[model samples]
Target: MPSSVPSFAELLNQCERSAIHLELRDCYASTERFEAWKRGERIDWEDRESWWHPYDQLIAETVARGVSVRRARIVSEPVSEYIRWEHYVTHANVTAGEEVRWLPRRQATSISLPGNDFWLFDGALLRVHHFSGDGVVVEDEITADPETVKLCSAAFEAVWERALPHHLYTI
Candidate 1:
């Protein structure tokens, strides 16, 4: 693993074929947006401009270049409030051309997953996210180790295969 980890934007820009993300945690650090959503705030689904984020634009652009951007979440069933809110906002990801899915944690009991969440870029470089128990990101470890990359790539594909597409998954 390299001490100097590149920003996600840099990795995405360098990606050629595919970028896959595996989110293992049921909850992440709460943000103002999440808090608002908890307070009953919702996106006017019809108003795309209102909720479109710069991150969504980056995903859109990456897809435009023919890269496959996919995200899979392994969440506990009877999901937490954060997952519910994440599910609602995922429309932004789909609208930006990224494929997204969800896998109940119970269904993934037999699979071999990394200890932390990760983004595998082009089946080569891996950015492993180390998060605090409170869900704040503590470090981003970048590695191009063949074994690590292979493990993450395989783990992502395994989860993706069994996961339900975002549209079909219910809270």
Candidate 2:
């Protein structure tokens, strides 16, 4: 039987052991915030209730349930403006209980990585993200292919091991 694909939120909710994400992009076209950052508007981390309404609650609750959430990113050395903004805003992720790490592209040259970004849930399911050339999200794929899962697991571990934690990674 073909398995039904679950939403990202569902994947997180159902995660028992861990929810690990590997991002191989320098920038994502998350419009509103990108524009806000471009305009020199920063996220007021002090105003948590306003900005963290639902997303943060979800992550916090999931973490409370004992699910380990981690995100690893592969970025270029001289990062894009988006990365700078993202680095600044990552405090929200940490506040929400996610562990994030940054790995420079130069450090990953020899690693065999998947072609797309992915979230591995409990080391069993893989949800791959496809992005357009300009960095807009296009689609997400969910799979349980054993070989692919093994590859992603190995690649993510390699990058995660070498990557710097969010606080120490400066753009």
Candidate 3:
């Protein structure tokens, strides 16, 4: 029989040692976890306010890791409904990196559901797959496949090429 599938955390651990790619859609768990890991904090799903803190950490960690993080959203709507004026304020307060790429709806190629918005991290790849009316599911894994990595890399680049620069107002 084929070897059993690896667990999500196990895959992440493996990815840390090799090349891995991930894609997240319509949700923020991957980002949240990335942040939590960076800050050495625990992720508390029960606390709503606690979530964004980790997301902020994730962004900083991604920058520090020197790995490329790419995001794409439907131009017709904001990338995240969770992102509000306060979110921007929080981002400004915590992050000091240059403007990262933001892909608008017009630029993004629409894919079907069961398809995810992606969060590609170099060290540990994390993907959050969202289903309408349902919730988000996560897949963390490692792979040595260059093609898979290239596909995600190209998709991010395509979106980035068409994305507008993000401008945030500092508090």
Candidate 4:
């Protein structure tokens, strides 16, 4: 961990070849959009402007530049409300050119995973996300340590190899 951590956008901007994110949480704090969805506020799927956001734009641009961006989530099922919502909106990630996958916790019993969620950039830099018990992000720790990078990279690849693609994963 370093004293200074770059923002997610900065890390992504610096990413050249590939980036992978591994999420181990079953749920996260609800955002406004998530709360609205819980209230039965549905987004028109056909309307790109209605659902596409700045993050999506950034992802699109990054993908257009030929960088491969992938995300894998290790979730416990029968899923929580937040996980269900996340699955529902995952198309946004696909639309933005990210390949997303989901792995059931039961299936991951034998895999060695890190204590925190993380984004590994080009198999070199890492941005580890620390979160509270309730799944709220507390802080991000940045590191370039070889051992840390190796662990996270292996963990992500192990999950990705076993996880189901978003289109095939059903909540």
Candidate 5:
């Protein structure tokens, strides 16, 4: 709704405001914090824990407030390791429910942007391109359109459809 790309925390806060759905290509950092919170452990600061703390609270609070949080993440190889970690930790805190969806990369779909407001992380580089209000606005990528947000939602659905049942994993 604001003319800006929502920060990860802002996005989770948005989720708290309404039913929230997210598509994660790789969620190592997020899953880690989720695991920590599930274990009731204070987040570690030396590592990349900031991105997840707010999200963890958002999920817990959302559930407490009777709002559901549904997530779909693309997992494979290294990413799968994080899934295993998150699965173990989350299960320890809460029983398996229909709230989270995990997808293997092979079954995941690639996302293409009409203009590059999108970011890509290949377990290596995190590439981000800027876009202007016009087509793919470069150098001054600031605002986002309702259509782009809709496209992001569609991308999440495409991946969610291919995700696996949580019980399938030992965690």
Candidate 6:
């Protein structure tokens, strides 16, 4: 992974057309949030006082500028509890104007996808994420390398073409 990159927020703010994310993991080891939810702390996304955050504000700002924000996740059919929690809370993302989708991992066997998750901004910059075995985010590499961007953009589109929209997806 490369260094000397701007913050994710800074890169997002620079986006002019689109921000597409490809999430290939079924579980993440950041267990704090998951444990809280597991303890039955319910979320009311409509209750902005409870679920809103600066990140939501950023997404709103980006979408307001007509820069489409989309996320596609490919998970195994019988997903992890974390993936189920993610599906439950996806309303927060949709509420902020970003589009979300889910694709079963079995459906992706034929596609050529990157090993790491990534965020492609405006089809120009690729923010590739590297995670440890336990799913901790170890590195975030930002690259303007045409090859990386092209590959990520193509992979995201391929997933998007087959993924089910959030509204239609079931845990």
* Candidate 5 per-residue C-alpha lDDT over 92-169 given as tens digits, one digit per residue, 9 for 90 to 100: 223312266666666653654233323221111112345444323344232245565566556655765767656664
By summed lDDT, the worst window of 10 consecutive residues in model 3 runs over: 14-23
Ranked by lDDT from best down, the candidates are 1, 4, 6, 2, 5, 3
lDDT of 3 by residue, 1-171 (tens): 553446534443333323222233333433553454546664454464655554455444544555333344333345453332223433432353324444444446563322445444453343434445434343333443565555665665566556554553211
Write candidate 4's Cα lDDT for 93-164 as tens digits. 999999999999999999999999999999999999999998899898989999999999999999999999
- The lDDT, on a scale of 0 to 1, for candidate 1 is 0.95
Across 33-88, the per-residue lDDT of candidate 1 in tens digits comes to 99999999899989988999989999999999999999999999899999999999
Minimal lDDT window, size 10, model 6: 1-10
Q: In model 1, which regions exceed 4 Å deviation?
A: 1-3
Best by lDDT: 1
TM-score-best of 3 and 6: 6
RMSD for all candidates, in order, please. Answer: 1.9, 2.3, 8.7, 1.9, 10.1, 1.8
lDDT of 6 by residue, 2-82 (tens): 468788889999999999999999888856667889999888756797888788889999999999999999999899988
Q: How many clashes does each candidate structure show, in the order listed? A: 0, 0, 8, 0, 2, 0
User: Against the true structure, what is each candidate's TM-score?
Assistant: 0.97, 0.94, 0.47, 0.97, 0.49, 0.95
lDDT of each: 0.95, 0.90, 0.43, 0.93, 0.47, 0.90
Model 5 scores a TM of 0.49
Per-residue lDDT of 47 in model 5: 53
Per-residue error at 141 for model 3, in Å?
5.2
- lDDT, model 5, position 114: 35
